[model samples]
Target: MKIVVAGATGSLGTQVVEAVRAAGHEPVSISRETGVDLISGVGLTEALRGASAIIDASATSSTSTKASIEFFTTVTRNLLAAERAAGVPHHVAISIIGAAKVNANYYAGKAAQEEILRAEPDGWSLLRTTQFHEFARQLVGHGKLGPFQGVPQMRSQPVAATEVAAELVAIASGDPRGIEPELAGPQEEKMSDLVRRYLAATGQRRPVIELSIPGAWGRGMRDGSLLPKAGTRRGRQTFDEWLATQSR
Candidate 1:
């Protein structure tokens, strides 16, 4: 099968591309970095020419709600339009476990994408996965106080991106089943504790403090809205196991 991996250079996108290739499929790498701007529809038609499946893992780092929503909605609309024109069989998206439930600006963008895909004519599959184990590293300097790095007051069942990538490839090769089962790590963990353990594992000296962010987004995080529910698939790599393998 011919597969198009949007955002092919991102953390999960890179792995998804490799996974597709390893499974004996032709993987087409697409991203702004690769000269394919998903938001503007530039190079979309050409990139999706012979694609049988498309995995949309593209994302922006923008925190602005309007900008994020525009970017996500535009990209999703363009991809679906191109897929319809190109006769693509499946549209697969990588989504967070509680994208719709959480009120984070980023989660709002994901939810918008999901809504767009749900209405599209093509066969669509939205795979909601838990936070990536590497999320700990991302949080290291994100939420900060006065000279102190702080973590968000949240819980997550973070799984490895590699494991999620493998599952995405498996889903891409199979028939679309609408929203698939959620994927999560072996155990639930506090976000702050995870980051602290991650720093310790890497021999870093940063103290990770926990902070309560105000809003529905923060409330959702604190109340377990980001966790995978029962009957979801779980990966084997624990945070400690993942931390142990990191060189830094």
Candidate 2:
């Protein structure tokens, strides 16, 4: 089977591409880097041609609700339209866990994307998963003001990106399952502890402070809206296990 991967250059997208190849499937990639503009729907149909499935690992870095929403909503609609024109049967997409329950920042866009997919649910398979293990490293990228860096106080069951990618590939190859069982890491960990552990693993010296994010979304984050629920698919890699794999 030939798989078309949208946002093929991203963190998760790149892993998905690797997963597809490992599965012995040919991959057609679509991204700005691949000369396909997802926002404007330019070059999508052509790229999607002869593809059995297109996995939308499309993402945006914007924290603004407006920008995030615009990017996800527009890109999702475009992908679905292109899939229809190209005669692709399955569209697999990833969304944040509890995105529908917490419409804040990036999750806002994901929630909107879910609504669009729901319109024709039979054609798409939606898998909601917790944040990736790399998310802890993402927090470390924030430069400290003095001796300590502030991270949002939250709990996460962070799965490995590779595992998520493998699941997406499997989902794309099968018939759309509507909403699949959510995926999560084996253990729940604190944001601050993860960041501190990340710093220690990489030989960086920085104290981490757990700061309370303001507003309803912040409340949601701190309140465990993003935690894995019962019967969710659990990934085997723990945060410590993934950390050990990183280069020193």
Judged by whole-model lDDT over C-alpha atoms, candidate 1 comes out at: 0.87
Off by over 4 Å in 2: 142-147
In every candidate, how many clashes are there?
0, 0
Off by over 4 Å in 1: 144-146
List CA RMSD, all candidates. 1.7, 1.5
lDDT (CA) for every model shown?
0.87, 0.90
Report the lDDT tens digits of candidate 2 across residue range 1-248. 99999989987999999999999999988889999999988788889989999999988878678999999999998888889999999999999998889998878999999989988848899999999998888777763758888888898889999999999999998999898889999998898899899999999888788888888667878999999998888999999999999997
Q: On a 0 to 100 scale, what is the lDDT of residue 248 in model 1? A: 65
Residue 52 lDDT (model 1) = 87
On lDDT, the candidate that comes out on top is 2
Error of 2 at 167 (Å): 1.0
- Per-residue error (Å), model 2, residue 97: 1.3
- Write out the backbone clash pairs for model 2: none
